[model samples]
Target: MTTEPPETGLVVRYSFLWPREHDRGEIEGRKDRPVCLVVPVDVGQGAVVVFPITTQEPLPGRSAVAVPDTERRRLKLPGDRPCWIMLDEANSDVMPGSYHLVPLETHPLRYAYGRFSPAFMRVVLRTMGESIRARQLRMVPRER
Candidate 1:
């Protein structure tokens, strides 16, 4: 028996939030601290993906995880900090919710299951961005 490879260009929505001052102590000294945010997409909605920007290689196979635009503006992520925007086509049953930071160093192999090329990932990001923009336009209230 053989398993099919994951699909490419699956559009998944994700949101990321940083920890408050109170929570800083919990992740002291850790750079890529686990963050919790919302994923609007549902299982089988399309595919799971992430947009991670870090100094290290991205964890494989994991779904797309987006870095909050606010964080990007404030921190100005360094280039050496390898940024990853992952997507997972499997496990669509899980609802969009929050996830804690699970150190990549801990489960190197498991996280590095699926990999995507820079060009391919760029295409995916562009497609998703267009879709999001369209959706936002539709929601805008028309002025008479």
Candidate 2:
């Protein structure tokens, strides 16, 4: 339970600002939600990127990876509905002092809920990579 996110694949409660919201002139997320940290592309540089997780079904044409039931049980995510890791966009923030990384109310002293399994993360990363190569990835800056 660290105050700062130390690695990738950690599921954290964050104020995730979506691409649509950003386009509508919203600087902050509509609400705090569960997000997965799938890539540690530049940990030493403090640039952490995260993909939002939602129980809502992905819109048509958007890319996403389904979260398995076992994974959901391990993480104790609320509800019994299906969840998906939206891969069409990501948010970047400087770690150790990110404005959008909110502490989980259930784990007040920690910034993360838990880490995703390596296997699941692999699937997520692969989908994200495809999005990246196809140039469908949108990077929204969340740093102040």
Candidate 3:
């Protein structure tokens, strides 16, 4: 893990266990993927939440925000195939202690890929807030 703590909006690689997968008895994510930190800092005592970013298009009834071309380029994400930040669910972990957070293979010492732009982050936060209020958001905790 990096000595520096992660900040809000930082995109980090993580083994994110989806809610459905967890319900099916999976203990870990099948693979590591880029995930965006949603909470500004620790929630409650030390838990932090992050939303997964995916190249797969959001399906019907799912909540997501497309990453604009400019933002994708700025973040150096792969391809032009389109990406979306999934907002319907998130992973919760014990920040500063979770073993799930990982560095990119290309950048061993760094745990972050990049941060989302403030304006775009605002849109994500707003949508996530709505989801939370509507009881549509699911959280999967990664702490043992």
Clashing pairs in 2: none
Task: Please give, for residues 1-144, the per-residue lDDT of candidate 3 as tens digits.
Answer: 454465678888889989999999998999798898865442565567889999999998888899998998898876677899999989987666678977887888777888989999889899888888888889998875
Q: In lDDT terms, how accurate is model 3?
A: 0.83
- Give the local distance difference test score of model 1: 0.32
How many pairs of residues collide in each model? 23, 0, 0
- Root-mean-square deviation of each candidate, in angstroms? 17.5, 2.0, 1.7
| Candidate 1 local lDDT, residue 2 | 10
Local distance difference test scores for all models? 0.32, 0.83, 0.83
Order of candidates by lDDT, top first?
A: 2, 3, 1
TM-score of each candidate structure, all chains considered together = 0.23, 0.90, 0.91
Candidate 2 lDDT tens digits, 1-144:
235644678888889999989999999999899898754664547777889999999988888999999999899876799999999988987766777877777767777778889998889889998988999999898866
lDDT of 1 by residue, 1-144 (tens): 112122443222222221332144442223443211113354444233333233344355333445444443343333324344432221121222213223244443222222333455465556456545554211111111
Measured on C-alpha atoms, candidate 2 has an lDDT of 0.83
On TM-score, the leading prediction is 3
